[model samples]
Target: AMDDREVLLTRQEVTVAEHGDWAEVELYEAYQNQTWERQEVVYYFSLPESAVITGLWLGDSAERSERFAYRVSPRGAAQAVYRHEVRRRVDPALLEQIGPRQYRLRIFPVEPQRRDWDQDTNRMVVEDGPSLHMWLTYRVLIKIEEGGDVWPLPQLAEKRNVYWDDTSDRLVNGEPMAADEETWLPPAVPATSFVEPGIHRVDFPGGESVIARPASDEDLPAWPEDLHLAVVLDRSRSMAGRQAEVRAALAQLRRIADSDTVVDVYLTASEYHGEEPTLVELSWLDLGSITYAGGQNAAGLLAQFEALHAGQEYAAIFVFTDGSGYELGDGGFDVSVPGAPVWMVHLGDDLPLGYDDATLEAIQASGGGVAGDVREALTRLAVALEGEAYDVVDGYVWDVLPTEAADARDALDGDFAPFAARWLILAEMQRHRGEINELETLDYLHDVAVEYGVVTPYSSMIVLVNERQEKLLDELEARGDRFEREYERVGETEGQNALTVTGVPEPEEWLLLALAAVALALLYLYPRLSARGTLFTKVSHH
Candidate 1:
């Protein structure tokens, strides 16, 4: 398996075009493979919370007309198409949302090229290699703060999976190379629609407009002077050195609340003696004496809290954790805070995939929220408590034809009706989460995603070479998650079994054999479980 460093990011160019309240951003990236064997590049990064990916293109040529832009389909179908194309040695690209505010891009079979270290020039230069050029465009509503509406840009943080420090002075095609540090966008004047104090509607080219209205005081619940708050601390191994930060946030929370507010602090991985209510002043000292150790016991902590409180309802419950590894006692995905609205605040830099799912489940079950940090969690909680809301656009009304936005730059002109429809569907899905059956909700979302050509949790974007591939994708989509596949054929060598077939289009003999070897190698290295709950055995070489 190739690591993150094998495929070199040779060049990057970004263009930001602003259109009123929202902005369209296009990112062009070129990656070079220095190895002799084919490679698949997987890039994992985050975008703005409100950003929506509208387009993606992959090709060897720089000309936009020569390349194919991917169309939206069910993620499962797109994945099937990508797999089918990969075996045939055809060009295909995929973009998927792996978690909240996180995305993954996959480009396969980057043709082998070469680069060597040049001691004379004191630079490792790219001798010759094929470059994979990619174009990604997304639209985001600008952030309106105290000063002005700021267009959000991609943050190429050093912690991202694809990044290189300054120590590696490298050159691509004899040109000086460095990683992208910042993005450039055109400046804009203040948005008057936001500053005005009345309900307003801004319409796009289509018969659609975003409507905003001020939040009235009647919309908020009455604030309670005597509020009971539960603070669940994740005393797991991952929180070893973050005690001071958590303590500081707790102190700030206490300061924001009334003096008579009751506080109960509990630690995971420790036996809950019972609901012993501690004041902020008392709990502040007790928190200093606590030690951090053991795996996260989120499930156990919630269970203990339930046992102690039983019928007692609090203002809200706050769980502090990095959403990392859990101990054996933790309930894993089955964990839930049933009685109260549980706000799970991530205490780390990047939220893990498992944790993100767990937080979403918790939120859906309890009706609270998940924040990237403690500060955000606190601010949102204050707004909910005070019956206050930010004066931003409430929602958009648009004639959404999910299937119509097939063009690459469909949303570039501020016609975000499809994107708006996608969000509306998602919001409805969230509202009906616990009410409707799981299968029904999933089916509804999947149908809408495919019909509207919008990328949801059930949908993704994939590039196909021909109509056959498109038909093949439809078949795969019909099969759904129950699509059982096994590779049964190998190369010309007898007594060798490499892959199992699911009755799709067959690849050429040479490509089939090449795929067989690759399949066998991959199976031997990583044992994959089939859809029927069976694992394939390693093939023996003669």
Candidate 2:
């Protein structure tokens, strides 16, 4: 503390702020007694080429005149690269392609010429005291291109040099900066943003932006009429807890359906018990008296849908279950009811083991339908009946344009225009399911990718099933090890008994060895002995 000849960096701090794909980084440094020192600070960072520099600020105040002139250069480059500079504080400073990998920002602070005595040398020397303060802030937008994987650039490391007056400059500490002293900034963590396969609107800080190109209006179809909805609810013992929720959802469906709409309600459980899943009139339908019992039979329920709607044409059929049902084989559900989309509503968390969400998705997709929760299934039915362009997020219903309806129809697999006209509504439902999260969702998607050869943006490198499989393998290995140890113990016990049989065999050992030898002899001779007559036959022949 007594030595005034040493320079010290008293304070250094860094702050990072993130907004969606964009991030703002600020670096602040304060040196002790270095106000008159002329120092050059260079920041080295790496960013994806897709990223664009949005803004830059130098000094403590935005209103303050630029006291430092900064230059940006690409990695391994000798000269500074000049690009577009925005004078307005609100605007961002743009830089052109400097290089492929890394970039550097060099900042030079203005300093006054001064001199001081070298106390150690007892001679005059130029003052190089640490008394300077500098703050640098910049914003970058990490643009994610279509079908491209990109992450935000991390914080940059600082390279600094202090000059002895204006004439002579020396590197700080006379050596390279210590790794610990040069703080490396961490990358900004991006928020989870979901984008459905089809075109949809995404809300950002400034305004709403549309992601993915939308289907053209000429591609949609007209809304269908004479549409009938059949709801097949799972009344199994497992669904006992969710009965109230099912009743409420049914009530909501009744409210949404028009008076002319024909809604048939069916409940399935063990042996097709309870109400027989009959086509009860909407008004006479009783949600209260419905009881839960038996094991779930999804096959029987589908058979009923096929029987009831044999001659009649239905707009859509919904089968809601706890996803626990008789194995419909590896191919899953292949039955398709003509002129109807069989929407599979997988209710509750107890999905069948070995069978995943992709199986249900494939089943529903094969039947020209979709699979989701109770709310989503009903919402799709409602939207189809309305036959209008409705935005699920805004809840705004637009007048059905001929071209728009045609575009919607083209989006779907069938000629049913209503199903297509409300494609956006369906798109919203597909993306906003509650079951999707970071961990499980990624794993589920990975399973889907492996099984069905389909990969989405949500797919992660980590396979979710691997952990469960590993646990199972560990359990099996432990059981095998225990069996092996038991087997060794039995062998050891037999060997000890053999050792006890010394010159004079113990009665028990002699008896056991005799029995074992007889057992072995019988096993060896059984096949050949069977060719000869039985003991009773031999006695009789003799």
Model 1 lDDT at residue 433: 52
lDDT of 1 by residue, 1-542 (tens): 32445555555555666665566777776666656556666554556544678788887767888777788775555666676577666667877664445566667756665434333443334444666778888876656567755555544311222333343333322344333323222232234355333333333333333333344545433335677777777776667677767877678667646467776776555433333322233245566566666564455556555665657667878777774642142243345436556776767553533232343445534545556676666545655554221211222222222234323333333365444545545444445656423556666665655554555545678876678777777776666451222211111101111134444545574676786698567544432332233232322110
Candidate 2 per-residue lDDT, tens place, 1-542, comes to: 12222234444454545544344555555433344433333343544322323223344222336333232211111110111000000111112211222234433332323443333443334444424455554444333446542234434522334222211221222322223433443343332353232332322222212232333443333334445777877777767787766776677667646645677776554564544556666567777777887765455557656666557666777776764553333323333323455666656523332122333232323232433366655554555455423322212122223332233322322212222222322232234334432334434333432332211222111111124323432343233121111101100012122112234555655775786688567545544545432232111100
Return model 1's CA RMSD, one decimal: 12.0
- Return the TM-score for each candidate structure: 0.65, 0.33
Model 2 lowest lDDT segment of ten: 80-89
What's the true lDDT of residue 384 in model 1? 52
TM-score top scorer = 1
* RMSD in order of candidates: 12.0, 29.8
